[model samples]
Target: MLNGGMKWMFLILGTMIGAGYASGRELWQFFGHESVLAIALFTVMFSICCYVIMKISYETQSSHYLPILERLVGKKLTGLYDLLIILYLFTTTIVMFAGGGATMEVLHFPYWIGIGVLAILVVVLFFWDINGMLSMNAIILPLLIILLLAVLLLFIKSNVNAMLFDWMKQSNWPAAFTFTALNILPLVAVLSAVGHQIKHKGEILIASIGSGVILGGLSFLYNQSLIQVAHDLLVYEIPLFAILKSYPYYMVLIMSFLLWTAIYTTAVSGVFGLTARFRDMVNLPLWIIALIIVTVMIPFTTFGFSTLVAFLYPLYGVLNLYILASILIFPVLKRYDLLS
Candidate 1:
């Protein structure tokens, strides 16, 4: 049970840690000084929501998110949220594509080439399907987490002399709700689709708690490191680069590759959710649907990675609050027999 739970946990982690979270861009956007309580609230809230959503999915043996969506918000709001979920997956995936292009731009490569490479890889892998994608994330995600932590920790160590500023304003605690909402939609799509395989409730417990703790810890540390270099943030598109001020050019190159991988995993994961949702309806191969989605999304990548993230993410976060609230309140409603 523990072993199975860890695998599912990795899947959850891979889905969550993508380019936005790994690049320090997402954290800086939602979290900063005086966010301790906010991050803590988000961690607990996130873990609970994951458990509720997974348990609902597991019990229902959902093949896709629609059935789970009905359970989450009932039949009345299901269609509304379903459309939102599809749109959420599509746009977030595009942001990941833009992220890859932006990462390559850091290496002086043309942005289009970077987007092209990631798009081809995503479509090709879909022909093989989700198994290979999850397997690859299982291997790569641990290393990504370690390297990212190592980089952030190193920065924190070397920058001890740097002065802190007005980073602890307490008003940011509420962003935790929106941030958690932003992530919860894609999570539902992915986790729900795997419900049939999860046999034990214990696995859900472990996966939920384990992923939340790991992500929350990383968010706090990464946010701290970014705060130290907040002044340099205006110039660098990817906030992860701010930590590399003292590193050799080679190390920067390595980090950039890691960032691109983060971007790729996320793009694939988003497309995976999108494909899972549409596969039954389209009378088309999953790969083709994915190709169509990616093709339609490619032109939007020119808006640039950071720009899309900056503009779209917060909007989605706000838009998702109702869905998030529904998920959070689900178990209570179910327990009281009020949801029917």
Candidate 2:
């Protein structure tokens, strides 16, 4: 049970800490500059939301997000939200691919090359199916957490005094809600597809708490690190690289690879959401559908990574708040049999 929960826990992390979060763009967009309260609230709210969504999905033993989404929004609004979920996944996955281009562009690789590499990788992964994604998440997420924390801790060590002033500001608390909202669609898209795989309520509980604590800790540290170098953000498209700038060349190389991997994982998750949604209708293998979908998206990556994140991330965040609210309030409603 412990091991099983850990796998799901990592999946949650892999889903959340992808291209935008891993790259620091998504976190910065929502919870930055005196966001201590925001992060705290997000951690609690996010954990509760995760447990609620997973429990709903697991109980339903759902293979798609439609049932879980319908429960939250009801039949009246389900079709509308379903369309939104698909569009959200498509746009966000494009962001990830754009992010891949941005990541590679930092290392002097051409933008299209980076985008191509990630698209190829994701399409290839679909050949192995969801198990491939699960296995990859298990392997990559641990290193992602470790390496990300290491960089964050190192930044904190060099500027312990900076965090003192940083933690005192709390005006950004409200941003937590929107941030959580921005992440809601993908969480619903990914976890809802795995409902039947969840073995027990304990697994949901463990995965929810573990991912929340882990992401919260990392987000806090990473946020602090970014605050220290916030001034340079204007010049760097990927703000995480600002923290990595002072490191040795080899460390920089390693982190870049990890960052790319972060982009890859998120891209794969986004594609999973899309492919899973249309798998039945396509009348083709999931991989072939993924390949076609990804190919069509590649042209859009030219819009640039930071540009897409700056515009789309917050817009979607605002849009997803209603759904986020539903997820948060679900347990209370369920107790009264309101949803059934």
Candidate 3:
């Protein structure tokens, strides 16, 4: 059995590597380019969110975030709260499809084929136990960290100039904040399923936030590398993959699988959450519920990748922000008692 610390680490890693983290689009959208400093700040905020999440998990220990929100916000507001979470999950699922499609397109595979392969993989993974899902992250986190670091470190040694912040200034701050609000919620959503299971809320909070700091720093490193390879970065639909292509042909396989694993993880989690919820509703068979969701999601998953990330993500981001603010602030008020 995985120890508590390992389990927590797995949760954080899986949550962190969600489609947004993998695709580089989440960072691209939020920080524009990827200023080391700005990404650091963004990570700080994300860490704070993680800290709060750990608090929720410590307090509840085996519950989802919505029930806590319902308590904090009341039954009516709770309804709205769950609705926003569902939307966040749905949007996340869409982005996973998009990211998977984009990665496939980069590899010279058909976009729909990528989507179908990932979607099927997600459905299969969702059948695992919740704790099993946690273990999967052990595999995922190391793979992602190693590959991502390899790319960033290679570019750094090559003396690439980081242009993440400069690129951000060219984009509007207001627009960036708008995107941040939306993107951040999905980050929160990924954690919601397991937030309550952590044993040491304080430690988990620190670790998760700390991870965000590292993520921000990495983003800046990536941005700098991208600047050096500006021509190549702009060529591939998936800029990050384009970076990996810089390596030997064999490494491309590693890079592609790394990217796909992240996308697959997100799709599985999102679909599992959706299907599990429906399974509880009206007492439907779990397989039947899963099948229903797969059918419904087939079309949305087919929507091209770049379109979902570029267009739909911002709109979704706003809704996530509103809900996050509500959830975060809900506990601060004098009217509510978490222990109650």
Candidate 4:
């Protein structure tokens, strides 16, 4: 049961720590100075949201996000939110693809080659179906998290004098909502598909609390590191590179590989959500569906990595607030039998 919970927790982390996030761009975009309270709020809210979503998914044994969406927004609004989720997945996956390309470009690989390599890998990943993605996350995410946290901690320790301890000026607390809302769609999309696989409610508790704590800790550390390099942010497209400037070239290269893996995992998750939703309708193999989706998304990567993230992330963050609200209120409503 503990292992199963950890597996789901890794899946959630894989879905989240994508290019924008692993690269430090997403964290900086939504959180920065005066965000101490915001990060705390996000940690609590994120855990609650995860628990609610997992509970609904487990109860319904959902095969896709639609049933979960229907329950959260009701049947009347499900269709609308369905379209929203589809679009959100489509665009965000494109951002991951672009991120893959961008990460490789840092290693002197051609941009298209990086995107093509990632797309091929994503398609091949589905040949093992859901198990492939889950296994990959289980292996990769722990290493990624360790290296990321190590770097963030090292930077914070080295630059302790630059660190701000202002806890009261938390005007950016509202960003907690937007950031959590930004992540809700993918969480629903991925977790709902695994509902039937969930054997115990304890797994949900473990995953929700575990993933929330890990992500929250990483966000705070990464945000602190970025704060010191705030002025250098404009010089680099990936803000992580700004933080990495003080490190060795080999460290940057290593992080570049990890960043690509991060992009790859999220891309796989996005394709998983999308292909699972359409597989029954198309009556095709999951890998084939993944192939078609990646093929279609490749052209959209031309929009550039940072550009796509900068534009779409905040927009979806705002639009997804409704779904986030519903998830937050779900347990209360369900407890009172208000959902009926």
Candidate 5:
């Protein structure tokens, strides 16, 4: 049986790797070669954020998510909190959908077919049993690790340039790294959900954060590899796959599955979160709500994937800062309140 700490670690690893590392897009922009520092910063921040979220969730255990929000921000701010979280989840869902489409295109599948199939499947899986759905991360995370390592091995064997030191000096390094943290905010939301489930709060929080440290360190190394081959990376739709293409088509299959799984997990999680939010208002059942949400959002897939990344991602950064600050300052405020 998995310990609660292990389960929490699995959740964080599954969530982090889904977008931050596996997508290849994040490391491409965030750290590139210079991403080493960004990754280090992220790991430390990630651990701290995990601790804060765990503390908050533990303190408010058995309450639904909204009441906790009301307590943290006060009733006067509840409307603002709902609006902000809704926007955040909505934007995240769009990214995941767009990313899923892009991943399909990268894997040589028809754009609509790939996106549509995954959307429907995710709806089913999420609604089939909401509580049981957490297990999806545990099941898929190991495969993502295996596939990531295989790609790394192939890149190494091909003698791909491993130095991206030149990219460390690029002007966008700071902006990119900043955006990477912004990009990962949805991850914190999901981690909080998992934290809500855990019985051993402190141990799970520490172990989950330890996983982030290990992952962020490894991601820094991988981002550098892309910088080493910057020219080739810029041209390919799926640059990581291009790197591993030197091996065999079979390798592409493995890589494609890994990439798609990453995007798919993020998409599935976001949509489920969104659907779960509206369960009380709708006259229909939970599955029906999930179905309607995914179906309605599916058409947005026709729009450009890169376009959403370019537009919504920066806006997301602004909102993320507030959430990050709130999480960070909550503890200090709590301490001060107690003293008073």
Candidate 6:
């Protein structure tokens, strides 16, 4: 049970700590100075949301996000939200592909070659179906988490004098809601597909709480490190490189690898959600569905990494607020329904 829970936790982390988050762009976008309170609020809200979504998924034994979406927002709105989720998964996965291409370009690889490689890898990943993704996350996320935290901790240690604690000026607290909302769709899409695999409620608890704590901690540390390099942010497309500036060249190369892996994991999660949603309809192998999806998404990667993230992320964040609210209120409503 412990191992199972950890697997799900890693899956959630893999889905989240993608190109944007790992590159420090997403954290800086939603959180920065005066965000200590915001990060804490995000931690609680994120855990509650994850627990509610996983509970619904497990109960329904969902094969895709549609069932869980219906439970969260009722049948009438499920179709609309389903489209929204499909779009979210599609666009974000493109961002990941673009991010992969950009990362490789930094290492002197051709951009198209990088995108093609990532696309091929994503399709190949689904050959084993869901287990491929779960297994990959289980192996990759731990190392990514450790390296990211290590870099952030080292940065914090060196820059302790620059750290500020101004809890009284936490106007950015509202960002907690939007940022958490931004992630609800993918969480639903991915977690719902694994419902039948979930053996017990204990796994959900571990996944929800564990992912929340790890992500929350990473957000705090990453945001702090980004804050120290706020001025240098404009000079680099990837803000994480700004943080890595003082480090050795080898560290930059290592982090570039980390960033690419993060991109691959999220891209895999996105493809998983999309392919799972269409598995029954297409009547084809999962890899074929993923192949077709990636084929369609490749051209969009030309939009570039940061551009796609900047334009789409905040837009989805705002649009997903209703879903976020519904998930947060689900437990209360479930109890009320039982009483009635």
- Candidate number achieving the greatest lDDT relative to the actual structure: 4
Ranking by TM-score: 4, 6, 2, 1, 5, 3
| Candidate 5 regions with alpha-carbon error over 4 angstroms | 19-21, 62-64, 71-78, 153-185, 192-196, 338-340
- Model 1 CA deviation exceeding 4 Å by range: 161-169
Candidate 5 local Cα displacement, residue 145, angstroms: 1.9
- Candidate 5 clash pair list: 31-35
Q: How many clashes does the backbone of model 3 have?
A: 5
Give the CA lDDT, 0 to 100, for residue 303 in model 6.
89
Q: What alpha-carbon RMSD in Å does predicted model 6 have with respect to the real structure? A: 1.2
Worst 10 residues of 2 by lDDT: 160-169
Q: Give lDDT tens digits, candidate 5, residues 1-340.
A: 1466666666666556654357566567555644555566667666666676666666666223465555456677667867766677676676677677777786668777777877777777855654545678778876787668656755755654564345355544355335544644555455445445667765656664677676765676577667656778666655676566566778777777787788777776676556656765677876777777777777775666655665666666655666566665677888888412
Question: Which candidate number would show the highest TM-score if scored against the true structure?
Answer: 4
Please give, for residues 76-187, the per-residue lDDT of candidate 3 as tens digits: 7678767776776776787787788777776789988888787776666655646556667767877787788887787677663443244445433444345445645444
Candidate 2 local distance difference test against the native: 0.88
Q: Model 3, residue 223: displacement in angstroms?
A: 2.9
Tens-digit per-residue lDDT, 34-141, candidate 6: 999999999999999889988888899888888888888989999999999999999999999999999998888999989999999999988999999999999999
C-alpha lDDT score of every prediction, in listed order: 0.87, 0.88, 0.63, 0.92, 0.64, 0.92
Tens-digit lDDT track for model 2 on 1-340? 7887898898888788878898898888887788988988899998998898899889999888999998898898899999999999899899999888888887899988888889889999998989999999999989988998888888899988547744565888899999989999999999999999999899998999999999888888888788888899888898988887888878877888989888888889889988889997879998999998998888888788889999999999999999999998888888898876
> For each predicted model, how many residue pairs clash, with residues at least 3 apart or on different chains?
3, 0, 5, 0, 1, 0
Screening candidate 3 with a backbone cut-off below 3 angstroms (N, C-alpha, C), the clashing residue pairs are 34-164, 57-196, 98-305, 162-224, 182-317
Against the hidden true structure, what lDDT does model 1 obtain?
0.87
**Clashes by residue pair, model 2:** none
Tens digit per residue, CA lDDT, model 1, 132-244? 78787888888888988898778878878432434456677898999999998999999998898898999999999999999998887888788888899999889999888
TM-score preference between candidates 3 and 6, better one: 6
Global fold similarity of model 5 (TM-score): 0.86
Model 4 clashing residue pairs (backbone): none
lDDT tens string, model 4, 1-340? 8999999999999999999899999998999888988998999999999999898899998889998998999999999998988898999999999999899888999999999999999999999999999999999999999999888888898998546768768889999999999999999999999999999999999999999999998898889889899999998989999999979999999899889999999999999999989988997889989999988989999999999999999999999999999999988898899995
Q: Using Cα atoms with residue i matched to residue i, what is each candidate's TM-score against the true structure?
A: 0.96, 0.97, 0.83, 0.99, 0.86, 0.98
